[model samples]
Target: MSSKIYSVITGTGIYLPKKKVKNEAFLDFKFFESNGKPVERPNEYIVDKFQEITTIQERRYVADDLVASDIGFFAAKKAIEDAAIDPETLDYIIVAHNFGDVKFGSNRSDMVPALAARVKHKLKIKNPDCVAYDVPFGCPGWLQGMIQADYFIKSGDAKKVLVIGAETISRVIDLHDRDSMIYADGAGATILEGKESSSPVGILTHKTRSDTYRYAEMLTMGCSYNVTEKNKNDLYLKMNGRRLYQYALETVPLSIKACLDKAGKDIMQVNKVLIHQANGKMDDAIIERLYKLYEIDEVPKGVMPMIISWIGNSSVATVPTLLDLILKGSVENQEIKPGDLVVFASVGAGMNINAAVYQF
Candidate 1:
């Protein structure tokens, strides 16, 4: 094959909030079931059980004054700086976030200008051709934005693109719901440059699937589960945890295998798997199943780097954040060097799932 343009990640950054909400912080929380029945178990046991299953010890919450766009700008600035490129040279700013800038102490989401425009304004980029937009594909949103960036690069329509995954889920959670603790606020960004090479490099292959017909409601926004709450108008993020878990277990491995297959790469050749930090146990199961699909008996150690223990699930922000950390050598025992093959995968709200194969 002749030389071709590929979307290669040139720079990356992440913004994790300073407000560290530890598992103990929720001990005093009055958790309630969807049926309005209060969880009667002692909070100590509940916290321990949660920790055992999710492996989340603490998660970050953005400061009261900040929202999704603010943190996204923070990460975008770092990525632009890291790439050592002029801001005006950028071609696109794609922000993937579910709740659009939900302000602190307010349940309403402000989406008039779009998060990407707000980020662009903060960046002060003068390029009118630098198209900006928002993507809301659930947790897979960030990876999907990256897939779109790849297309722009390959089509020769753009030279550089900024893909950001940012979320302020804390502002939209029902405090009384136990699942509320699973959410955190964070942002991550990457600058992808179109590089022409004779051999395959940068993004290799990708696949995405949306099971909306039957699984659209797997995750949604709903009124507070607390029956005592009078604000029926304010809805928070809701999920069918059991069904979602099972759904991911059955699908994520297949998605990964499919993407790797498209890349003509074997599972054993992958150096790392950057998966969405949703549930620790579920991630383990998904990886295990992926190995089973290859007829392998053991998953390589350190193949998947996990941050959910401390960072929690920031929805679309998870995979990109994880990638940034690994690249920066911040993730313990996890590092990616040149010529390494890695997989980025995520599953979330739209009952959506996606995976991308990248070679550094």
Candidate 2:
């Protein structure tokens, strides 16, 4: 029998900015009236409500000198080192991002030179045949890139791929916007290489779904609505928390279960569930519902590890960062052993949801 070939994640890396913004920093944040009058909420009220909703205590922001691609290059270098692979041998470089790279202090997004191409240049990979591209699937873009790598390996079209998710979201967020508190800057990457194997040891199956018609506007980046703001032209992320909350509550759990079903695995077989670090409460609720779907009376502890409280949401970077942390034992008391089933899932701005089943 022909041996099975699998695209397995050989290594992972992450880059988080040096600056950390704590919840208290938002105490003086201004909320404007329709007339553009500055209205201030008490610090306690603001922090309490934010914690109650998103459960984020702090997040990171890029240094004044760096851009998203710069951050991603650092991560890519480390990922290549971890994988112990020469950059010249990479078959492809897939970069997933939302805002290409908002220049240090401006919202001017640079897209002419794609982030992947920039990283490839920065890595100094000499092979012109090493293809590089970007995927902008909102927050799930990184996972989508990894999924694409899996298919490439499966089709004999590629041998090794570098998948990266990086974002400098702080640049796109309005300083006065409440949603600003929920966004951060960071990057994560994984090196996937095709290898011949007898058993499934890599990406098994995945399910991706989108509902743009219904939730397209739920989370968006656009000009500030406040007429009082000096720069109405300034764009920032705006989200309808209630709508997104409802949508995630309804869609994510089922998407995960469906992915597991596609992989012909039971819920109990999954050792780690690395979900998008979007919201703490929402993630907890989703895990609970997933357990209920399997008719389990109690949710297992450590099944879902969350870093949102400290990292906030770095869009596409969340899952890979969290995965890298756990894989490297940076996360206390958590580790993924060989032969363990690891499930990766996320829901993002495209109103897109995706889940992939993998054997570690």
Candidate 3:
């Protein structure tokens, strides 16, 4: 009989930029009507609306000279230290991002120099055998990278992998668009180690699905759906909030339930449900729906922890950053213990959705 080799998440780290921008900061920003005419809403009214929808009161922004990979490297360093693993001992370095190395305050990105490679160089890892790569799987990128690391461990292709999700998404948001209120900037990371275990623990089950066929146009960049010409060349992100909210409320819960079912567990066994910190209200509604699927009437507090109120959605970086904060006790009264069941889930840009069941 062969012993099971489990991929365990040994450590986690996150990096938030120094600058914080309050919701009130957007008061002077103009909002346009469908006809391109400026809306007449008061500044306080707009700020309150944003708070009601996203539950986000502020978000961080990177310095104008910094890039996504720079923050990623910082998070990775802390994760490696937390794991007590030598950087040169890592077998693979996987970076998950959407805009690549997006320079703060600019739409331009330097993709030729891959973000993973940049992180490796910044870490001063000397081993040529420590292969590095990137995964651009929308906002679910970090969770997906963790899934891929599990695969490598199971296949005996790698013993240790470093996975990071980082982004300067604020650089991609259209300041004139309301969607900008939901986007921010940050980075997070984890180290996965392969170890032989007697029990069935670590990453148990995971599933990913995309609805690009029907919803590809629901969220996108480089122009609005019906408008063109000057806006055609615009490179900022634009989303149909109504469609996105509807899709998330319907799809994300099913994905979580399906993933837990595959692991031979029920919702009652879950200790924590760490979802992508997208919108405060939308996330709350999704969790409420999840409880209903199991026929539970009420959604308990502290079961799902939220950081979006202080740090808006940084795309791929959301999950890991939230996890790290909770684990470190930075978020009061929330913690993950050994042998606890933790379910991770997220949905975003590709119209891609994913969930995973893990034993911590």
Candidate 4:
């Protein structure tokens, strides 16, 4: 019998920006409501509340000299080197980002040639056969790109693909919004190489669902909450935090369960759940509910290794960054080995949620 082919994650890398933004950084900034009203609370009290919920004490921010694609290239380079493959050998370069490259001090998004193409150029790969493109699926973009790479490999259309998720949320946030503290900048990349085997070993099953009917506007771009601001062309990332939290808790767990079931694997069989680091508290709730779906009471310790407390939420970059960190033993007490069953899941803008179950 002919063996089936699958795309497995063979190498991973991440680029963390040099600037570390602490919660205290916003102490002097005036926060306001969407309706042009002051928050009325002291900055310290607000910061404390934000930390209690998101658990993000600090997050990385790119230097003014860098942007999303810059970091994406850095991460892609490391992943390519880690895989120890010539860049020209890659069949595809898929970059996952929302705003392309929002330059420092500029609210504009620039993606004329596409970020993937830029990364390809930066990598200096001369192969014309290598296809490069972008995936704009919000926070789940990286995993979605991975799924696409798997399909390309499964169809015998590609051999090795680079999937990267890089975002600079810091550049698109309204300074007056307390939720801005949750934003950060970073990039992560994964190298997926195709392999044929007698049995399935990589990218077993995945699922995705979009809730645009009622949740499309949960996270959107809007003018600064600081009504006194003069610049109208400047847009910032905005969110209805209350609704987003409720939506994620309700759907993210179910999406993960469905993916595991499709893979014929249960929650207990999984060693890790690398979920998007949006809110630490919300992630904990999602896992708790995920365990409850399988009639389990307590979530296994170390099943989900988190970096949000120190990395904040870098939109699409979170999951891949977490995976890279864990694989390199950078995440304390969190590690994965050969044959470990793992799950990657995320929820973000588009009201989108997705999960992929794999055997590592």
Candidate 5:
């Protein structure tokens, strides 16, 4: 008898709004600039200070007519089509998002049924047992959703699971705020299918840690209850950039090493190191630290910096978007072995850090 293989991502798809916002375009906005000068953009100064940091170039945004659910639905359908799986086979759908469809009335979880209904109606699938809900875990939400789906599939309770991370950060962003400048809006999906094999090359090991005691490090709160005028600027995302960076640099490398160690693999065995496309400078520092800690002379150059110039940070959508970019020839000509490991590590707003090891 073969050991239960578990779940693996069979198909991946990403949907970026057709509209592309560039860094140069941001300079024209009065709020994005400093005293009518173009030096206010985060990338402008940060990239110059750090040679390794580059630009995002372009990022997608939802049309004024669209919302987060629309982006989520588009990515989900594409992923389902790519997997060649009927919607009826999808036993579960997990949406990872901090912002939901309705700002006040509906929670993130409420969007799930509507999304499932849309998929059902669009695909015309007759599966009656589909379960759908949202997992609101900030940036690490997508990986957490993946971990949950994996468990459900492994328990023989589900055959096919659709995991999606979608965000419309633009809606909540205080365009006048510098901290919100780095955020954009997008969505991506992955199909995790249950299988029976001896050695499944899917999600191998997962670990997460939280330091919520530092919750104030990044927060958004209201001073008044009135929604009309008093709360006009209450919905924006705020962060202590320096503090968040400290936590990430301190925690993520150890988490990555521990994840690899749990899988009984060495650092050299990993092919791609997919860290959250946070700040380009911070990412470079983390990579350098990792290399020095491991005593490795030559650090691998497959590290992808996805969120620097264009899209900013799309929160949970970052990783899947990075995956899509890699699959779509962004990282072409790179040699990747069959059993090579891929590392996904992220430190999010809740002071949460998570790392997952995958073999491809």
Candidate 6:
């Protein structure tokens, strides 16, 4: 008999910094323009593009003093509380981040273990059995982490899994670069517990696609083979926006359709569509194309687009943060119904795209 693993999102939480950065604020910043000259703020362009595509007003980030893990801690606390599961019961903690707390030759492999210990200590969980590790992926980290946790839970290796996607993309960005304007920092967490039911409310199907050739289209770090002694700014998120847009527009629809097909579901059956929140314009263009191509009526609505405008892209944390906002009644009185199919999709710097279907 095949062992069954039912993965359910028992709890969800997110953390953002107290500071708020508005579109108008960008105009005042010296770095917004070249040679210290004032230039038209990019916020208007972003907003107009986003509003046409997504339903988002604001996003969040981490405070100046805090790192990605700090935000992760806050989100984890909320998820654990929501699940009513003690920290002591958690058998494993998986942290997903592309931007970790590594600086100039010093590594922080202990970061996850330290975070787990802190949570365990604060909760006063005596002699709790918990192991912590980190998983790094450009954008699919969160969903992939969920899949990893599901394997352990289904195999009876772990009773509970605390999975978090946290990122401090802001730290890696060269503030002078225009790309920095679209990067932010935040964290989100989910609690996964084993269930006896064969059917689960989370992670029904997941599909991943990567075109390694296009990997160079959006890269940060320099490769060892082609050693070019560039400045520090070269080590930031760089992208051929047009190429990425083309690839995403072409690939995402098929990927989403394939996932739904694998799950034996239809596009119209889905209630909400949650993507990586890459940008407002790109998302809108894809949605428009999908509608035209599929000829599907009643396209799902009320997506979180403004979050990217306000908080920029928080890398791996984007989806979970948006989910937290939706769950916490931040999505303008929208109610999630039973059997509602929610789609999670992401496209990131790896030239990687993934789509997963979840029913709740």
Which one is best on lDDT? 1
The lDDT, on a scale of 0 to 1, for candidate 3 is 0.90
Give the poorly placed runs of model 6, Cα more than 4 Å off: 1-4, 29-59, 102-129, 198-200, 222-234, 297-300, 303-306
lDDT of 4: 0.92
Considering lDDT, which of the candidate structures 1 and 6 is the better prediction for this target?
1
Candidate 5 per-residue C-alpha lDDT over 1-360 given as tens digits, one digit per residue, 9 for 90 to 100: 567766888888888877787655554343433233434446555433333333455456678777777788888888888899877889988888886763432222235555545545555666678877778788888888888888898788888999988888777664544455467788889999987778857888888887888554564532222233745445456566767777778878888888888888888777888777777778777877776778986676655444446666788888887876676566555443567678888878677788888877
Q: Which ten residues in a row have the lowest lDDT in candidate 5?
A: 219-228
- Superior by TM-score: candidate 5 or candidate 6: 5
* Residue-by-residue lDDT tens digits, candidate 6, 18-43: 76655444443334332334345565
Give the Å shift of residue 75 in candidate 6.
Answer: 0.9
Residue 34 lDDT, candidate 1, scale 0-100: 90
Candidate with better TM-score, 2 vs 6: 2
Question: Candidate 4's error at 329, in angstroms?
Answer: 0.8
What is each predicted model's overall lDDT from 0 to 1? 0.94, 0.90, 0.90, 0.92, 0.72, 0.70
Off by over 4 Å in 1: none
Per-residue error (Å), model 3, residue 248: 0.6
Question: What is the C-alpha lDDT profile of model 4 across 143-255, one tens digit per residue?
Answer: 99999998999998999999999999888889988889999999999999998888878899999999999999999999888754476667888999999999999999999
What's model 2's TM-score? 0.97
TM-score for all predictions?
Answer: 0.99, 0.97, 0.96, 0.98, 0.84, 0.81
Q: Which regions of candidate 3 fall more than 4 Å away from where they truly are? A: 224-232
Estimate candidate 1's RMSD in Å.
Answer: 0.9
Candidate 6 has what TM-score? 0.81
The whole-model C-alpha lDDT of candidate 6 against the native structure comes to 0.70
Give me the displacement of residue 234 in model 4, in angstroms.
1.8
